[model samples]
Target: MAGRHWPGAEPLLPRLSRSANHGVLWFGAAACIATFGGSARARRAALRGVASLAVASATINTVGKGAVRRERPVLDAVPVIRRLKQQPFTTSFPSGHAASAAAFATGVALESKRWGAVVAPVAAAVIASRVYTGVHYPSDVLAGAALGAGAAFALRGVVPTRGQLPAPGRPPTEAPVLPTGQGLVLVVNRESGSATAASALIRDALPLAELVECASADLSGALEDAAERCVALGVCGGDGTINRAAAVAAAHGLPLAVFPGGTLNHFAYDLGIETVRDTAVALASGSAVRVDLGRIRPGPEGPDGPDGCFVNAFSLGVYPELVRTREHWAPRIGGWPAGVLAAFEALRGKSPLEAELQGRRRRLWLVFVGNGMFQRMGPMPGRRHNLADGLLDVRVVHGGRTPGLRLLAAAVAGPLTRSPVHAAVRRRRVRLSGLAPGTPYAYDGEVARSGTELMIDKLPEALTVYCPMTAA
Candidate 1:
C-alpha cells in the first residue's frame, strides 16, 4: 500500500498517523464530544469511547505484541515522503493505532448513533494510515481492528448500555393533545444550567405555550399561578424545580410536561425525557404515563408539620449537607468539580445522625429513601425500571470512625440485604423518630428542616407526566 501513493494524500495521511502516536487524537475527540454533545447520552458515549480505547491499547501492548513478536516491514519500496519520521519499534503483527481507533468508534456507536457516525470516519482514516505509513502489513491492521471491536463488545457484556435495558414501565395515562402547545403553561427557571438556551428552543418548538421565566425564589408562586391558569402544567429545570411542579400538578389535577434544563436531570432522564423536543413530541401526541410520588409527613403524635413530596429521592445525614455544599460552590466552579469538593467538605468532622427506624434505634451516617425500587446496574446505584412499583428502596450506612471508607465499601458492595457496614431493603412505609429538633433533610436536591418525627411512604400512580413511551 505504501509503494503506490495517490496525489494530494501524502501530507494529510502522514500527519494523521503521527498524531495518533499514543492515543492523543482519540482523547481529544472524547473531550470534545463530552463538552459539546449536550445530552446525557453524549456524555456516556464519550466516557465509553475512552474506556474502550484504554482496553484496546492495553491488550495490544501487553498481549498482542508479546505473543507475536513479528518484525517490522521493510521500507525500501516505500516513498520517504509518505513514511513516518520515527519508525515504531514495537512488533508489527498487530497495530495498536488500528485497535484503539476501532475500539473507540465502536464504543461510541453503541451509546449514540449520531455521534458514532461523526467519529467513524476519523477512526477509519487512522486505521488506514498505519499501513499507509509503511509501519505494518495490511494483515496486521485488519487483525488489530478485529481485536479492538471485540474488546468493545466484551466491555458491553460487563456493563450493559442504557439501550440494552428495558424502559421504565409506567402505566399509560390520558391527557389533552396540544399540537401547538395550547392551554399549556411552561415555567422555566432562568438560573438553571442550559435553561436560558433551552427557553429559546422551547419557544420554537411550542410557540403557543405560555412561558414564564423566573428565579428560584419565585418558582413556587409562578407554578401556583400557572397551575390555576392552564389546563396542563409544564416545567423546565432540575430535580428540585420538578418536585415543586409535580406537587402543584397533582393538587390541581393537571398533567406535567418536563423539559430537561438542568445540569444533572435525574427525574426527567428517568422518565425517558432527555430534551425539549422529547417532551414537545409527547405533548403533541398526548403521550404520557402515571408514576408514583414519594411523600414525607408528620408522625401520629408529632407536631403539625406541612407534608412534602419527592420525585426522586429523600436522604438524611451527610447527603443533605453535601447537597447544600454543592449548591454553594456550583456557581463558582462547575457541577462535577463542585460535587467533589462538597463530598470532602461534608464528610470532614461530621457526626452520625441518631434516629429510630420503625421503632428500632440506629446510628447511621446516611439514610436514603428512593421513590421506587432502585437497582444496581454497575458499580453505582442506577435508574429505576418501574416507577409505580409502590416500594421505597431503603439503604443505610452504619456509623463508623472512617465515614469515607464505610461509604465507599457500601457503594462497592452494591444493594445487599445485610452487611456489616450497610443494609438495604424494600419497604412500603418507613417510620422515623428520635431525630434532634430541627434536623435537616434533603428531597429532590432541595434541603429543608424537619421536626422530630417523620413518616415516609409512596403515593402510587398519583402523577401523570409527558414522556415518549418508545424512547430508549
Candidate 2:
C-alpha cells in the first residue's frame, strides 16, 4: 500500500534499513519465542503479553498509513517533509513504522517490567525516527505513537485470579480437596509385564472401590462384568493393558483413572499422569475434565483384539519402535531422563517407513497420533491442544538420517516439529498399513501388534479425567 501511494515518496526501504527500527522487531520476536519456552504458566503469560502488541501494531499501521496517504516526491503534491518521492498515490492513515515500534514494546514488556521500561523508549525513538527519515509525516508518527502506547498499556499482564502465585516461592497447595467421591472399579492388566506394579497400584487404589482382574486374552469380558459399578474406572497396566477397561468406562460414561505401570506410558504421561503417585492423586481427588479419545478400527492389535477406544493416542509407522524403546529401556534408567535415554538406544538401528499426507507420499520414522498436550511443551496444533478437544493432533515424523537417533535427539533437544524431515498435518481420519503382526503399533502408549490395516479417528470428547481447577 505504501509503495503504491507513495510511488515516488520517501520509500519505506530507507527507514527500514536503519539498525534501530528493524533490529527491535527481530529482538521482539526472539523474546516472545524464548518467553514461551518457560514453564506452562509463563508461556501463557508471554502469549498474553504479545496479544496487545499485535493488536496495536496492526491498528497503528492501518490508521497512520491511511491518514497520511501522502503523495510521493515524484507526485504533484507539495512536500512538507522531504518527498522521498511523491507517493505514487496518496493518504497515509496509520504509520506502519510507528505500529511496528509499538508492537515491539508490547513484546518487550512480557520479559519483565524493567525490560519493558527500557524497550518502551527504544520503540518510541524508532517511531520518531520514521518522521525524521522523511518517510512519514509528524502526524503519522504521532498516531503510531498513540497506537503503540495504547498497546503497551493494554498488555499489563494476565493474572489468573485463583491460581495466582501463592506466597512468592511456594507452589500453591492442591485445591482444597472437595468431597470428591466416585464409584471406582479397578481393572488389572494380566498381560506380560511386572504384575507387581499393577498389583501394587490396584491394591493401593482398592480403598477407592471395587477390584477385578482380567487376563489379557479376556480383557473385554472382565471389563464388561465390572463396568456397571464404576463411576470412574481405574486401569492398572501399560496403555494396552488397560484398553478394554477404558472402552468399558467410556461405554458407561464413567471417568477413567490410569496407573502407568508399563515401560512406555506415553498416553499416561501425556495425560499428566507421569508417575504412580500423580495418577493416584488424580484418582483420589482430582476434578474430572472431559477429553477426546480415539477409536482405532480393524483394531491395531490382533484378531481377538476387542473393538476399543483409546484415551491417549494411536499410531502406526515408527510408533512400534518408540513403544519398544520406552518399554525395554525406561525401567532400567527410571523416570524421564532414563525413558529418554532408553529411546535413544532403541532408535539407533531402526528403519523409517514411508507414508503419505493427504496422498502426498513421504518417509516417516516416528508418528505419534496424540490427544493430550505434554505439560510445558506447547500445544500440539490443530487439535484444541486440549485432551478434551474432539480432534486429534496427528503427528508425522519423516525420520531423518538415523531414524531412531533422530527420535532420541529430538526428545532431548526438543520435539521434531521443525526438523526438515519431520512434518505434521492434521486429518479427520487416517489409514495405516504395510506392517505385519508382532510389528509394533501403539494406542494410548501401549504396544499392540501392527497388522494388515489400521484406521484411526478422533473419538471426540470421550473422556472425563481429573484436572486442576485452572485446567478445568
Q: Whose lDDT is greatest here?
A: 1
Taking all chains together, the TM-score of candidate 2 against the true structure is 0.49
Residues 285-402 of candidate 2 have per-residue lDDT tens digits of: 6545566678777644545655656766676666556566766665466545656665566566666666544455666776666654432221222212356545556665565667
lDDT of 1 at 183: 97
lDDT of 1 by residue, 1-472 (tens): 7788667778788899898889899899999999999999999999999999899999999999999988999999888888888999889989899999999999999999999999999999998888888898998999999999899989999889888987777899888999799999999999998888899999999999999999999999999999999989999999999999999999899999999999989889888888889999999899999999999997665556568999999898899999999999999998999999999998999889999998999989988999987767211246888889999988888898888988988888854667888888889999989898778899999998777888999999999998886852
User: Which candidate comes out best when scored by TM-score?
Assistant: 1
**lDDT for position 145 in model 2:** 61
| Every candidate's lDDT | 0.89, 0.55
Clashes of each: 0, 46
